[model samples]
Every structure is written in C-alpha cells, then in structure tokens.
Target: MNILLWHVHGSWTTAFVQGPHTYLVPVTPDRGPDGRGRAETFTWPSSVREVTPAELAAAPVDLVVLQRPHEERLAAEWLGGRRPGRDVPAVYLEHNTPRGDVPDSRHPAADRPDLTLVHVTHFNRLFWDNGSTRTAVIEHGVVDPGHLYTGRLPRAAVVVNEPVRRRRYVGTDLLPGLSEAVPLDVFGMRTEGLAEELGLPADRCRSADLPQRQLHAAMAERRLYLHPVRWTSLGLSLLEAMHLGMPVVVLATTEAVEAVPAGTGVLSTRPEELARAARRYLADPEAAARDGARARQAALERYGLKRFLDDWERLITEVRS
Candidate 1:
C-alpha cells in the first residue's frame, strides 16, 4: 500500500515507516510543517519516500493518514482535489489528549462518517467524543534502542520539546522540587537554557537538545526516567526510555498510569512522593537495574516494533479494502 502522511511526530513516524508498505511523505522547498517530507534526525526505512505536492497529484495513494486537522484539506488540495475519505480512503490519527473542556472535549473528526478516527492511547479514546466517526486504539510502538542502561549517573532523564513554553502541561513546573532530590538532565528540541530559566544550579538541572541516537545514549546513563507530563495522549520518549532499560518515575495522570505498571518504577500524583521514589532509585543501583529490567521486558511485550507495525498493516488493509 502507498500510505500518505506528514512527518509531524518524528519518533512515531520513525516506527511507522518501518512497516512493509511504501510510505509517501510530502515535501516542500522550505520543508515546512505540512510538508517536512523525510526525517533528518531519526533514521527511516527506504520504503518511506519524499514527494512534492505536484508529484502527489499523479501518485497512486492507497490511503491518506491524517495527523493534524489541516492535513484533511491539505491532502485533498495537493492530490488533485481527490478528497480524503471520499476519493481516497483516510484515517485521522489523533496523537494528543483533548485540549479544552477536559472530558467534554469533542474531536475534530466527531460525526464525520467518512473518516475513521484512530487514537494513540485508550485514554484519548475515552476522553475525545468521536460521535459518529469510527474509532480505534492502536497504542504506541517504538524501535527499541536495546537495554543500554548503565545507571552510572545518579540523575533523572526527561524528554520534552519547548519545555519552557509548554511548562506545566509538560511538567516543567514539577522539575524544580523533584531536582532537589535527584538531578535532572532534560533532552529535546529547545531544551537549552532550562536550568537558567528555572534558576537552578547547573548541577541540579541541565538540558541539551540532541539527535535521537545521542539522546538515547545519554538517557541510558541516567538512573531513572522522569515523565512529568500532566496531559498528553502518551509520550514516545517515556516508552523509549523503558526500551533503553531505565526505570521510570511518572506522574499518575492521563495514560501514564496504564503505561507504567507497578514494579517497573514508581507512579504518583504527588511531587514529593515522586521525589522520594527518585531518591530511592538514585541511591540503589541494584534496585534501579532490577526495575529497569522489568521495564524493558514490559516495553518489549507491549510496544515492540514488530507488534506496532503489524497492527498498522492490519488497519491499512482494512481501510483500503
């Protein structure tokens, strides 16, 4: 199948294009958001091809995979007015928790009979009112970075983009108190200057923006992973951390409670409690390694690359048929 999708979420797309089907990604001169085309930081399979809007009009697309709301219109306009879910089969992959009104949030595809709505987490499936739109939950699948954890650094690793702007939503506010117990090293886009912004010493908390390969290596050295995101469908970074054989300390909110099972690490609603858990892991290398082993096992069982690709393939066949 020739699947059409944008390069919106890098980690998810990295896992997605590894499937059997040929992927058609849109590219522009500037490589703008709607048309970033191929990935640069993360490696992708050869099956993923980059094409311009003009080329897409003549291309044979089996199905269009919609991520952002504007993609619905953009796909149709670029594909010679072949409207998605009408001329071409389409599915809206919702990668976020509803933004407004909490549980009362209505999905953009709500009541749209033509397009099927797919969510990355079950938590998003329950919260977003899909109404008449067909819905499915495929969870998350990540390319395992293997069990590279050393736990040599007595600190916590966090991955969040633009943490200063997203702030509370991505759990930047919780880091200060948590850092008092265990130092934090944050990784992602625009993560530099986080320590200065938070008024913390360079040792207590520091940030760096590294490529996926380097980021994974850096994270593996940390004692534990910290997921402070207050609301999100699910973060690929948390799963990636587990795949790296690092124990985790996550806030028991949204889909995190389901992702981080007991014994894998600690899940708490309180910041102080999370701090204590981080301290325990930082002090005991053996205990951290034990929990990290369990974390790697659980991640393999649930979010392995093979399983994730298989699920997507099945959905593609169904949608195409």
Candidate 2:
C-alpha cells in the first residue's frame, strides 16, 4: 500500500515508516518554517517526493497521515472532496499544544469525515470532543534506544533541541539554580544571546547537537534529567531520558505528570519542591540509580518501537479498510 505521511514536522514519523508496507515522505528544501518542503535526503525505504495540494488530490494515496490540522485544510481543497480511501484516508495528529493563533477545539482537524483526530497524549485528548466520541490517544515515542542506557555520571542534564539561556517554560531558566545545587549540563543548538541572561557563559554549557553515539554516551553519564516543560505536549526527550536510566525532574504539567512515576522520578512545578527533590536524589546517588533503573524498565516496557509500531499498524490498517 502507498501511505503518504505528510507533516511539516519531522523527527516523529520513524515508527510509521518502519512498517511492512511502502512509505512516502515529502521533502522540503529548507528546514525552517518556510521550508515546508520535505527533505530530499530522507533515506526511508519506500520513497520520497515533493507534496502539494495538487499532487495529494491527484494521487491514489491510500492513507494520508497529518501531523497538524493546517495540513488538512491545505490538502482538502485539492482532495476535491474528502473520502475514506479513494482520495485518501486522512488522519490528523496533534503533536503539540495549539498556540495563540489557533482556538482550543480539541479536534481542530476533525471537520472532514475522512480525517481521524489523534492526540499524542491522553492528557491532551481532554481539550476536544467529537459528538462525545473522543479522539484516539497515541503517545509520542523515541526511536533510538542505543543512546539511552545505564551509565554512571554525576551531572543533571536537559537535552532541549535548542540552547537555554534565560529560564524558558522548559527547564533552561530554572536549571541554573538546579545546577547550582548540583552541576547541570545543557545541550543542543546554542541559544546564542541568552547566555548573558542565564548568567552561564555559553562555554560552560555544551551548545551543539552531539553526534548520535556521543549523545547516548552523554545521556548515560548523567544521573538526572531535568524536564521542566511549562508548555507544549509531552516531550519525547523525557522518554529518551527515561530509557537511558536517567531519573528525571519534570514539572507536573500536561503529560509529564503521568510519565514520571514516583519510583521513576519526581514531578512538581514548584522550584523549591523540585530543588528538594533534586537534593534527595543528589544526596542519595544509589536511590537516584534505583529510580533511574525503574525509569529504564518503565520506558522499555511501555514506549519501545515495537509497541509504537503495533499501535500505529492497527490505525493504518483501519484506514486501509
């Protein structure tokens, strides 16, 4: 079957592509917001092509998976009219919180009969309704486990895709004080100017994407992973952190509250409370290791690629039917 997984967003489509059928991903020239085009270098087994409303409407695409609602509105006009399979069986995936530009209708992409609304986390599924029929809940997953495993490192780490200078909704802002209590390491593309605000010179923090192998090593070396996501859906980085046996410290917001069990880690929005929790783990390294072990066990049990693939296969099969 020819499955067209169209999402301006990247990095989250690995599971669907690992299936038994052919997979097609659209390529974008630039990776920025304007770079709506898919990447030509994508080496997924099935195929790659440029996606536009015209091609989407014309192709006998079996299943069209959307990562955002805006994609549906763009393709719908070209779909001629939405239908179950002929034009495409479309599924809209809500990957993050709806921002200021969009309203809070949970099923913002459900306007089309052919479109199935899917939420990345059950906690996020609450903000929408479908004639009392709730949207499907599929948690986002981490693809590479090799990067996360048992290791003995003393630092607390937060691996945001971008650098942290000032405290943002994510862990960057508060991490300094947390790090002051215990050493902290922040990694990703540099935040550039925020170092002054953060008061940590850029050099003190690693501000670049580590190569895959190095990244895993870095994750394992850390005993703690700070995930202070004030806004947005559950972060996959948290799951990756769990997989690596890094006991986590996350704010009890959105899905973070559910992802971290008491044994796995602590979830509190209060800085002092979080600081206390950090102190507990820092003071008792063995307890931190125990929590890290539990976290790894939990992640391997629930968020493995096989489990994610199985759930996605069921949905794709439903679309095909």
lDDT by candidate, in order shown: 0.92, 0.66
- The global Cα lDDT (0 to 1) of model 1 is 0.92
Candidate 1 structure quality by residue, lDDT tens digits, 1-321:
799999999999999988888999999999989889889899998999999999999999989999988998899889999999999999999999998897889988999988889999999999998898999999899998999999999889999999999998999999889889999999989988999999999999989999887999999999999999998768999999999999999999999888988899999999988999999998899999999999999999999999998888888788878
Candidate with top TM-score is: 1
In model 2, the worst 10-residue window by lDDT is: 34-43
lDDT of 2: 0.66
Q: Lowest summed lDDT over 10 consecutive residues: which window, candidate 1?
A: 312-321
Q: 193-307 in candidate 2: lDDT tens per residue?
A: 5446577645444344565446657877776887767777787878888888888888888888778887898888797777777777777888888888898888877788787
Return the top candidate by lDDT.
Answer: 1
Q: How many steric clashes does model 2 contain?
A: 10
Clashing pairs in 1: none
